[model samples]
Target chain A: AQTVTQSQPEMSVQEAETVTLSCTYDTSESDYYLFWYKQPPSRQMILVIRQEAYKQQNATENRFSVNFQKAAKSFSLKISDSQLGDAAMYFCAYGRGGSEKLVFGKGTKLTVNP
Target chain B: GAGVSQSPSNKVTEKGKDVELRCDPISGHTALYWYRQRLGQGLEFLIYFQGNSAPDKSGLPSDRFSAERTGESVSTLTIQRTQQEDSAVYLCASSPTGYRNQPQHFGDGTRLSIL
Candidate 1:
């Protein structure tokens, strides 16, 4: 069984600043994938970024990037130039190479202050 | 039609009653998933459907929960003898394929309340 943990229950970032949300997971599988999802008040879950365990290089999507440390079982998401729209509940998820299920973390509520 | 669609955006039912939540995945998507998200908690996997493979029901919390997907189209999650604890947001998602790297697009979710 794989478990994802987000130690921070809530976080706040000033507008135009950068913020990093931490995530860690426990999985025995050598090959897997990590993902960060955002859910706004609308309750719509949106994919933020993803990292492949096999790829040593971290994944970056514009202002959104991930610091993936496979050896440490850590995958953290960094949001640069945070905006009000970035204020949402973020969840970290893990999925094995051959599995269809994704294990999710409890989530961290992020508030972007103006 | 464009993204995953779930019907009855909100549902309220009494205890011991049965309820069904529907999910319509994106066209041409080969994978569908069901998840439950309780208040202030993370999403919990409920069931998964990929192509013609046998659905994975391992994440279902109890026997009271059952889901069925017809081919690669619509899916329904049924809860029998619903309990108060069953009140949560039922979410549905679908991916182009079942591959681990593929991103799953999600629906707005149905807010189920068992009174």
Candidate 2:
């Protein structure tokens, strides 16, 4: 069985600043994928970033980046130049190479304070 | 149409009644998924449909819950004898392929409320 854990239930960062959300997962599969998703109040879940287990370099999408430590099974999201629009529920997810589904964490509520 | 589309953005039904939720995956997508998100909780995988393969119902919570997809195009999740606990946001997602690297595009979700 695989599980994703987001230790921070809630996180806040000043606008234009940076914040890091922690995530850890337990999986036996050597080949997998990790993702960060943001769900705004509109209810649309948007993919923030993704990291492939085989890759040694972390993934970055504009202001969003991930510190993927495969050995420790830790995938954290770092939001640089955070904006008010970044306020939402962030979820960490894992998907094994051949699996059809993604295992998601409980989620972290992020607030961008001005 | 554009992106994954889910009908009836909000549904309010009475307990014991049966309800059907619909999902329209993005064009050319080969995989579709169904998930449930309880209030203040993360999304829980319910079922998966990939191309012509048999649907995966392993994540389904109970016998009352079932889903069907027509060759990866559209999917409908039907919950029979709905209980209060069934009141939650039902979300649908689709991806270009079922591969691990493909990111799933999600719908706004149907907020189901059982009265």
Candidate 3:
């Protein structure tokens, strides 16, 4: 079984500042994918960014990026120029190759102070 | 629907009652999944269905939870003899294929409250 861990339960950042959320996972498979999902107060889950294990280069989508270290089993999310809208519950998810289900972390609540 | 769609945004039921939650995957998706999110908790996998075959059922917390999918389209999650612990948000997701590396698009989720 694969497990994703997000040690931070809650995090806060000043608007326009940068914040990083840490995530680590346990997986034996070499081919897998990691993702960051944001769930706002509206309870809508949205995809923030994703990283493929086979890729050495980290994935960046707009202000969201992931620092993926496959050997260390670590995948962290970095948000630059954080905006008030960035406040939400961010989750780290793992998906092994050829599997449709995703294993998610406990989630970290991000609060942006304007 | 353009994205995975779930029905009855919210549901409240008494204990021992049976509740059904529906999920309609994206048009071209071949894989669908059901997960449960307890208050202030992470997502707990329940079942995974690809086409008509369910490849995994290990994540279901108990036998009270069961889910089924028709072809590659809609799916229904049924909780029999529901308990208070069953209260949570049931989420549905779908991907273009059942491949694990593919990104799964999620629905708004159906909040189920057992009273």
Going through the candidates in order, their DockQ values are: 0.84, 0.82, 0.79
- Ranked by TM-score from best down, the candidates are 1, 2, 3
Candidate 2, A54-100: lDDT as tens digits: 99999999999999998899999999999999999999999999897
- Which is the leading candidate under DockQ? 1
Q: How much TM-score does chain B earn in each model?
A: 0.98, 0.97, 0.96
Of candidates 3 and 2, the better by DockQ: 2
Which ranges in model 1 have alpha carbons more than 4 Å from their true place? Answer: none
Q: Which ranges of candidate 2 are over 4 A from the true structure? A: none
Model 2: per-residue lDDT, tens digit, B1-115? 6888998999999999999999999999999999999998889999988889888899999999999988858899999999999999999999998886599999999999999
Q: For model 3, how does the per-residue alpha-carbon lDDT over B15-85 read when each residue is reduced to its tens digit? A: 99999999999998988888999999999889988776645888888888888888888899999999999
Task: Quote each prediction's TM-score.
Answer: 0.98, 0.98, 0.96
Q: Which candidate has the top score in lDDT?
A: 1
**Candidate with more favorable, higher TM-score: 1 or 3:** 1
Cα-based lDDT at residue B92, candidate 2: 98
Interface root-mean-square deviation for each candidate? 0.9, 1.0, 1.3
Error of 2 at A59 (Å): 0.5
lDDT of 2: 0.94
* Whole-model Cα lDDT of every candidate shown, in order: 0.95, 0.94, 0.91
**Model 2 TM-score, 2 decimals:** 0.98
